[model samples]
Target: MLIRKAHSGDAQRVFDIRNQAINHQCVGHYPEADLAVWTRGELSDYFIEVVANTGHVAVIDNQVTASGLLDLETGQVDAVFVDPACMGRGIGRRMMDYLEQQALQAGLSHLILDSTLNAADFYRRCGFVGERIAQYQSPRGLTLACVPMIKHLAR
Candidate 1:
């Protein structure tokens, strides 16, 4: 697998992955309409920002298999997902590496993320510690409870 920065063209794949998680797991925590609103290209505008920011993807045989983004201002992880078929192959870890390096270069001292219960352990293994209780806007209206984890980037 090769990792590289993602471009604007990657938005569709990124959007698809996010929707998969939102539909399958309450990882997104918002209602379908809200998810659509936030994930839509014109509304949330995260994709464009992610492109302008630090976005990266893992390509396996020329196909994007995993992706992540590091927000410089807050050092927050916007999204980190591996293709369902590519799980257990360490793609997630590689994506994290991409985000971490970007964060470090952006002079961020810490990295933050709201992690679902299923992924909290993964972040822990990546050296992020649970820092606070978190709520995300979801279909359930603040019904999403995630652990806010932060990793102090070692300069």
Candidate 2:
């Protein structure tokens, strides 16, 4: 697998990976209404516009299987998603590793993320300690239960 910075052309694929994870892997952890709202693809423009310049994607055999973003200024890891079919294949881990490296390069001491319920364990395994900090309401007004997590980067 190859992990690299995303480009403009990878937007749609990144969007697709996120939708796939939410619809398939995350469905059981959320309510039907929430899933419907999330999978409705409302963040299309943001993914298309900002992801390319600010995110990373994992490629396997020339296909994108995962995507994520690192916010340099905020030290936040945003929108990390792996294709449901590609779960347990270490793609998500690789993306997180890349993001942590970026954080270190930016001289950040820590990284944080608001992880969905189903993904909390995954984040924990990547060295994040989290708690139920708040409920995130989507633009469509669906409430998502999330855990805000933080990881201290090693020097």
Candidate 3:
């Protein structure tokens, strides 16, 4: 597996992985209506631009299997997703590890993120703890439950 910064051209691949994970992996945790709203245009062209500017992706044998983003200014991790087919392969952990390293290098002492309900446990295992910060609402007012979490890094 290769982990590296994402480029603009890689946005579509990243978007696809996000959708696959949401569709296949999150169905049990969310309503089909909510899932439809969440995946539809949630990963947009503008989002791709942001990922290209501030995200990382994991590639296995030339295919993007996972993606994440770290915002240096806010010390926040964002948009983390692994392909459903690649689940249980430690790809998410690896992506988080890489993001944390990048945050530390940028002199951040902590990292924050809002995780989908389905993924809160994964963040907990990675040493983040917090609570349901807010209900993320789409433009149309559709909601996806999320937990706000934070992790303090050791100096």
Candidate 4:
């Protein structure tokens, strides 16, 4: 799998991956109402902007199977998602590694993310600490329960 910076053309695939992951993997973790609200949207313009800026995609066999983003200024990692069909293949780990490396290269000493309930353990395995319950205010105006996690990067 090749992990590379995302471009505008990757927006749709990234969006699809995110929704698919959430819809499939988050079933027992989130209420159905929350899931419906969260997944009720098409490819968003904000996603396009993110892809053009801080986004990255993991491609295998020329297909985008995962996506991630790192906000350099805020040391915030966001939008990390893998297609449900492509899970359990270490794609998520690779994406996290890529994002963390980008953060380190930008001189960030720590990174934070609001992880979905289903993804908290995965982030813990990635060396992030903190499982304080948090409410993530989505851009679409949803208040979703999430785990606020942080990791101090090794220099």
Q: Evaluated with lDDT, which candidate comes out highest?
A: 4
Model 1 per-residue lDDT tens digits across residues 1-155 = 88888887887786677656555555344456654554454424666566545678889899987788877899889678777767788889878887888889989999989887668888999999995767766543445567988899999
Estimate, for each residue in 1-155, the C-alpha lDDT of model 3 and write its tens digit.
99999999889888888888889878888899988877786556788788888989999999989999889889889879999888999999999989999988989999999888888999999999977558877554787778989999877
Model 1 segments more than 4 A misplaced: 22-52, 138-142
Better candidate by TM-score, 3 or 4: 4
Pairs of residues clashing in candidate 2: none
Please write out the lDDT profile of model 4 over residues 1-155, one tens digit for every residue. Answer: 99999999999999888889889999998889988998897887877998879999999999999999889999999989999898999999999999999999999999999999889999999999986898999887888889999999999
Task: Name the 10 consecutive residues with the lowest summed lDDT in model 1.
Answer: 35-44
Which RMSD does model 3 reach against the true structure? 1.7
Highest TM-score against the true fold, candidate:
4
lDDT of 4: 0.92
- Residue 51 in model 1: shift from native, Å? 4.4
Cα-based lDDT for every prediction: 0.75, 0.86, 0.87, 0.92
